[model samples]
Target: MDRIRKIFLVSINNIRKWATNPRIYVLFILITMFLWSSIRPILSFSKEMGIRVTPWVFPHLASSFVGQLILMLGVVLLFCDAPFIDEGQPYFLIRSGRYTWGMGQVFYIMMGMTIYLLIVNFISILILMPNIFLSTGWGKILGTLAENHGESVNEIEYISKKILLSYTPLKAFVLSFILEWCAGTALALLMFVINICLNRAAGATIASLIILLDYAIYSNFPSVKFFYFSPVSLSKLILIDSKGISNYPSNEYAYIFFIITIIVLSIISVLSVRRKDIQVQPAV
Candidate 1:
């Protein structure tokens, strides 16, 4: 109990220290405000042009930007100055139970993302709320519903009933938040692992080269079937609709594969930390 409390406090303090830093806060606020501002013009343009863009798309874009920001932060705070721990010296996490510290870090990141997503979601909803309300007239609503229906039963009416029954925008936002966060965190952890494995400059260059090579291969190769599992590829789903992808996995399969990949990578990370020696540096 005492150990858990200590780990939690340490994690909280670490996050707070990062948050309170003037440069970090400035960067975060600027990026967030920029993204918030973008939603209005996008929504207005979509409305004027009669584009069928989802209200969720703005938040999804904001989430991806946030993911990139978090990745930068992780690189700065966790790996920038890490040094090899000598056998004679006791590493902080090794002494404090590495697993607890690692899990605490993941929780801290998730919390940060949750707060960011909430802010972005709020801004997006503010932009779309007026449209949703004013467009509630029978004709407008019917038109919207008509656009949604296929050759089968009406999608708009069915969705309207669900909405009337209290499936509010807040609920939808929260559901999207969970899915986006899962996808983001999993990709971030995997990136961290790769970064650790490739600590040198040459290795970083090779990683970049490999990324370009893979892009070419995936586009040109006839047999590269599992590109969807790649972080760069899968992350696109958050912004673009599933239908927009050239090779998107089926809805059910994507979720299953994503969850499994995340779980497996998370497990591998934990095992590496437990058994492998990491020359992790301190956040400057």
Candidate 2:
């Protein structure tokens, strides 16, 4: 118990120092602005139509555009090196045993991912404050069927059906927030594991490219959507088919996959960090 408390204190201190960096705030603002841009048109349309929009709409749209690609890359860049490559790492490890240090990194990565998503989603909700409201129901616009009969017909119908059949707005939003945080943590762990074997920049690049490639392959061959690393599958699980529904993997399966992936990646990360040599130069 005492050892655990010590590790928690050390991890919290590390998080505090990390939180003080201006780049973190800059990234938050940049991401918030980018997400707002994507949602601005939808909010404008909702206003023009004089319809009340669900609070979840902004987060749903933001998650779709942000996608697994950006989420994985953002986490990789934000946390890959900070955990193990700092010049202060040796001192930290000496003060807090290897296991504690490893656990601290895990805690930091998980907390950072959660906080980052919370801030992004909070900003999105704030942007649509006028329209945001709690409801166990779908918004009128989303509940309505798409009138278009061309290439978008199938996509629109799928999304409408999924939203109508799935959990309530607030329930869905909460589930999505939790699931996306888990998925992001798994992705961050994977990056950290890679960074243990490679430099931070290379680790981030390779991990990001791996996700992008998975997305590309999943796009071309929908049958492969059940693959564990498929970003499309993760997005489906996180966004609840906000963009559109796919035929390969169901929402249930995607959620299960993320849970399993999280467990697996977390184990790998902790084991790797425990055995890793903390010799890298401090991050610039």
Candidate 3:
């Protein structure tokens, strides 16, 4: 219990800067930009048609094959500096040793990414709340857009019929949060492990590449066969077939994939802390 407490405290210390860092504003700005890109096309249509959407805009964005790419790209920009190495880290590492400190860093990444997602989700709800009323279902604008298959406007974002039928609005929001939180943690761990083994540039570059590949696969490949090659794609609930009848992966598959990836990466990170000569530097 004491060891766990220490690790929790260590994780808090690691993330404290993010709270104080002036760069936090950049994350807010990125959230706005990414959400705008996803919802902009439908915004005008909603206003013109006087559509009051439900407070379930998140799944609409997360379920979009392309919008998933944009949101994860925003994640990359926010947390690519995993292990968040700084001048103070060596002292902490020296005190806690490799295993304990590495666990702290891992916990920090998990908490950090979850908080980022929370902020993004909050902003998303606020955006919808202006004209939105409490509703437990997809409202008029989204229903019409889904019915028309998003051809009602030019390149609009949409929640597909499959997603609408498979999960209610509340379920969709919960699924989006959980899936995205897991995927973002995996991405942060990817950066931490690579940076520990190699360098920061390599870490950030590889993580960015994975997200770009997700976009490429959605844009060009358009097959569930390729989703395995891109970790970010695994987070998109839309691509995962709810009925188990489609070619896409199952929700169970996504949960298992994340569980396996996170466990493997967690083990590697803890083990490599002693052996890998990490000169991980801090970012502002």
Q: Top model by lDDT, which number?
A: 3
- In terms of lDDT, model 1 sits at 0.46
Clashing pairs in 1: 82-280, 82-281
User: Highest TM-score, which number?
Assistant: 3
Cα deviation of 247, candidate 1, in Å: 7.1
Candidate 2 accuracy as TM-score:
0.82
What is the C-alpha lDDT profile of model 3 across 72-176, one tens digit per residue?
777777666766778878887888777888898888888888888888888776666556667887888888888888888867747687678789989888887
The lDDT of each candidate is 0.46, 0.63, 0.78
Candidate that beats the other on TM-score, 1 or 2, i.e. the better one: 2
The window of 10 residues in a row where model 3 has the poorest summed lDDT is 36-45
Task: Enumerate clash totals for all models, in the order shown.
Answer: 2, 0, 0
Please give the RMSD of candidate 1 to the true structure: 8.6
Ranking by TM-score: 3, 2, 1
Is 1 or 2 the stronger prediction by lDDT? 2
Q: If scored against the real structure, what TM-score would every candidate get?
A: 0.56, 0.82, 0.91
Lowest summed lDDT window (length 10), candidate 2: 149-158
